[model samples]
Target: MRTVAGTGVAAVVFAGTLVTGSCQASEATGFGRLHPEADFLGSSVPVSERAGAVGRRTASVSAVAPDGLPGLDVSHYQKTVDWPGVAARGAKFAYMKATESTTYLDPTFATNYAGSANAGLVRGAYHFGLPDQASGAAQAEFFVANGGGWVNDGKTLPPVLDIEYNPYSTADWAGWCYNRTPAEVTAWLTDFVTTVDDRTGRWPVIYTTRGWWNHCTGGDVTVPAHSPLWISPVASDAGGPPGMPAGWSAYTFYQWAKSGTFPGDQDVFAGTAADLAAFAAGPAS
Candidate 1:
């Protein structure tokens, strides 16, 4: 069963933190309130107002997302077909692969970023953080130097910081990190957010897997103000309330499936169409 949804940006350079220094995940961990008191209100954009509107059309049968905020995720450049065609497939926005760590970036980043624009889809980029470079300053400098162009306009969604642990990469990249514990990872991530925010004038979005959230962000981690969350869950149970972010109170994006015939991706984010709009609004920029 593949759960699905939509995802964004373009230029990016990822760095490995666990290998950069001794940052522990535990040292940076802090806690705050979780869950929003608000309800999941419906979208202000009516189904009849969608772009492909020709005749009387209801959301259930409409190709455009009911909320008029369809989206997609592009991890590979070659995999992208006609950017316009994919966008017409009801995709209003997208997330593109940027960097993976301090030393590497996704090979397909540039093309996908441009493709999303050509397709008329609002796009954003993300980076896979290296646990080794815990110094917020170092990580920020690396990220800005590498992917700053993606945020030139400050119109797209905030760049996403993808954090995950690769056991195979532990010895060389993950083990040497300063304060490598979950708390430390949280602190480093905070630093990354701060640095990126200062440089780009945009708060960042956080993307992580279920296991990482459980182990890295507990009641201890303090997510920046107005920070949105992009969460990936391997199972449907991950949809429960507890799956939401602690400080933010709710997740703006949720990756439900990793494999499927998604409009433009090998993976998809699953959430109400309104979530798409929120992503489009970007990081309070």
Candidate 2:
């Protein structure tokens, strides 16, 4: 596959290291603690929503997953995808990257969004959260206007906030966000979430890693109870917490493999396929 680009520098290309529940920070793995820590506590989502088990098997859709419904998160990096081929493989849903910061929109978002749905898969749009670029609310408005809005249709997954590592230029490992305070991060998240929820009837899904969440929001950034958690944790828990972060008690989505054959990042939806369908229906009222 050819590289399509556009995930931004520190946003998707430089994925740092996946942080799970264990919060592993090892020099050997290049896990660096860039976020300042004072004190904060957290878990993930709600206890009842959590799968409460390690899932994800490196196999095809027919193969047993660690648990929950199966899906993928794709961006322009995937080039042109065969949405029908992916759906035929049993992917129940998919998330397409729509925008990053205020100026860059994923070039493949429009095609992927319509294609995935036409192929019979639940589809959602995600924004790569860039705290240093602009206010969260401003970014949210920009994102929504650019296709991040959601209607409670049973087939449309709510919008997602992809908040992870800081801006690190892929060419030289040069980073952007330098002195971002934890409080500032938390405020940014709150603004983004509230703005999105107010515009749409549903809260946006939060995609983050344990380390990024903790560092950016000072451990447990408080969002609406309805906002969902989508955590990315690497092998062996990455020496970080496993199940989730602090503010949440569980997770709604888990991105398990970045190199999985599923196209992009392979994920588990935290429940059965039926339950996942209902989740696609929209958040709890």
Candidate 3:
């Protein structure tokens, strides 16, 4: 089996190209219709069962004492993770960026997943789902290929399909000029999720900003009953923004901020220590 220090991983370079087009200011914000075919991931064995084989379980341990939640997001740049140390410090779970396109792999993905597992943090991986790609299946295949395989029978958390607007693309385009319409982007995301489920026997989690969820999905996609939702809402020091969406009981995770230090790296994540444990548990059996 391949081995590396979990804390040794880091982020990698984005293609960093610019595409130009004006983005609709109103396009950002609502949960679209959950897709009907989104029910595939529910059939996997209970999360506990999967973790059983992996051994040395500690998904329920308190990683942190409620400074909020204990979670981390692993990107190409966050190549280093002191898994055992982080878990000891207050980290309970991790979301690793696995792949964005066919050619790219988050530089630290394999090492981080292995290291995080070694440290006993419930872990999952996410693919930066891109709409521009001609076929969603191609991107999913790339993720599965380059993303590391499971180290043991212990099931990592379900994979995530991250549908955020490419930061580098957004930066290069100046303001949101190179982005696509919300409808177009949503369709691409839906297609990618469907293709991945068909291939992996595991349905993916959808991670999106409030704006992206509102504009792209807009009550059109059908989410599986078991699929977890990871929402991002940056609020003021006073508290969260007004009007959290309705019909989102499926919301199991969230990204409350973009800055500050997390257990694995300097990135952010959504979920308290308990929530992270629930996340690590995978879907309920």
Query: Which regions of candidate 3 are displaced past 4 Å?
Result: 1-69, 148-152, 168-179, 223-226, 236-238, 241-247, 259-285
Residue 253 lDDT, candidate 3, scale 0-100: 57
lDDT of 2 by residue, 1-285 (tens): 112344222212233443211232334434344221110111121112123222332322222345777799887777799999998888889998776655455667778888899999888998877677678998898778777888767778999987765533221112322246777778888899989988877789988765556545677646736688987663445333355766788888877655464788777788887887777776544
Q: List lDDT for all candidates, in order.
A: 0.49, 0.65, 0.49
Candidate 1 segments exceeding 4 Å error: 1-68, 148-155, 167-179, 236-242, 261-285
Residue range 1-285, candidate 1, lDDT tens digits: 111112232222123222111122222222111111110011111122223222211122212222224455655533545677776666666776555444334445666777777767667877656555436556566656545333445336667776654321332223323236767767777788888878877777777544445445554446635467775433323224325545556556654333233443332334544665455555345
The TM-score between candidate 3 and the true structure equals 0.63
Candidate 3, residues 44-148, lDDT tens digits: the string is 111122212212111212222224455777564544667787778666677776655543445566777788878887787777654554457767766665562
State how far residue 279 of model 1 sits from its true place (Å).
5.2
Q: Where does candidate 2 stray beyond 4 Å? A: 1-64, 169-178, 238-241
**Each candidate: RMSD to true structure?**
14.2, 11.1, 13.6
> Considering every candidate listed, which one attains the maximal TM-score?
2
